[model samples]
Target: MLIDSHTNLHGETYAEDLDAVIERAREANVSGMIAICCRLSDFEEVSAIAERYDNIWCTIGAHPHHAKDRPDITPDELVEIARHPKVIGIGETGLDFHYGYSPREEQFRSLRAHVEAARRIDLPLILHTRDADDEMADFLESEMEQGAFRALLHCYTGGSALAKRAAKLGAYFAASGIITFKKAEDVRQVFRNDIPEDRIIIETDCPYLAPVPHRGRRNEPSYLPDVLTGVCETLGWTPDEGEAKTTEAFFRLFSKAERPS
Candidate 1:
């Protein structure tokens, strides 16, 4: 069994045949998935999908890209909404300096707020970081000093320095379809050497980075095997071994997610 730890299944990209897409995922051996909601407005739709599918779960929080839009969202507000049974994680949140979609200050504020909420609720934080490696590492370090909280650096393609720092801080690193890119050997190396096997997970971040063989095409939960294959190769593990390790890692981090029977 496989679990896609991060995805945006509520996006219009999957509107035409969301049911079919989900069925394909099951057929491909993807046992479960966490549908991420990057905007507060979309949480309803994202949660609805999670409620409709026994194998699906969802998260509540803002992406750093939309940080400026909801600069006033409080940690208390996040904690309140996250009380829902289906809400298993605190964010798809963190800094994304590459796009500069939101001011660095706003992004930092939002990230901290999400971190605080995760700590308060004892749920894992799903972090998204980009070109702001140094800042991100510092922020996480400072936050850890305040109080420990579980977090995953989703789709990590950052520098080794950041990876080292995050690992030291007890953060998990989730590999994405990016690992399967022909030019991603450096990323593969980081996962193989730097990240601990027990602290690693896999994702699709679909409607986005699709692995090779399916590169340039729309990604979905069904394509997770390709990413898993890449991760298994990087870690020198067989498919079954990789699945067991990652599945254990997933349940460990997102403890709120009920294991599929």
Candidate 2:
């Protein structure tokens, strides 16, 4: 069995035939998935998808790209939305200097709010960081000082320094299809040499970052095995071993999720 710890199944990209997409994933042995909601407005749709699928879960929060628009979002609001049983995580939130879709200050503020919400509800924070390693690491370290909160740095392609620091703070690192790219040997090296075995997990981040052989095409959960193959090769684990370890890490971090029988 394989679990796609992060996915955007509710995205418009899958609207035409979401059921077919899901069936394909199941056929590929993707036993579970987390449909992430990067915008509060989309949480209802995302949550509905999770509600309809026993093996699927969802999260509620604004992405860094939308932080400026939803700058007033508070921890209380996040906690309220997270109260739903299908809501198993708090965010796909963090700083993203690569796009600057939102101001850095707003992104930082939003991330702090998400951290507080996750701490309050005792759910993992699904983080997204890009081109802001120094500030991102500093923010994480500062938050850790305030209080510990469970978190996973999803689709990580950050600096070695940040990876080491996050590992020290008990943050899990998710490997995405990016690791399968030819130029991403540096990222593979980090997984192989830096991140601890138990700290690793795999995700498709589907409708985006499709692995090779499917590169330049729309990504989906069914393509997760390609990521698993890359991870297994990098960590020197067989497919079954990698699946067991990553699935274990997924449930460990997102403890609210129900394991499939």
TM-score quality measure for candidate 2: 0.98
Question: How do the residues 74-186 of candidate 2 rate in per-residue lDDT, one tens digit apiece?
Answer: 99999999999999999989989998999989998999999999999999999999898888888899999999999899998987898998899999999999989999999
Q: Which stretches of candidate 2 lie over 4 Å from their true place?
A: none
Overall lDDT per candidate, in order of appearance: 0.92, 0.92
State, as a TM-score between 0 and 1, how close model 1 is to the true structure.
0.98
The pairs that clash in candidate 2 are none
Displacement of the residue 225 alpha carbon in candidate 2, Å = 0.8
Per-residue lDDT value at 216 in model 1: 88
* Model 2 lDDT, full chain set: 0.92
Provide the lowest-lDDT 10-residue window in model 2: 6-15
State TM-scores per candidate.
Answer: 0.98, 0.98
**For each predicted model, how many residue pairs clash, with residues at least 3 apart or on different chains?**
0, 0
lDDT of 1: 0.92
lDDT tens digits, residue span 1-261, model 1: 899999989967999999999999999999999999899888999999999999799999999999999999999999999998899998889999898999999998999899999999999998998899899999999899999999899999987899999999999999999998889989988897788889999999998999888998999999999999999888899999999999999999888787888
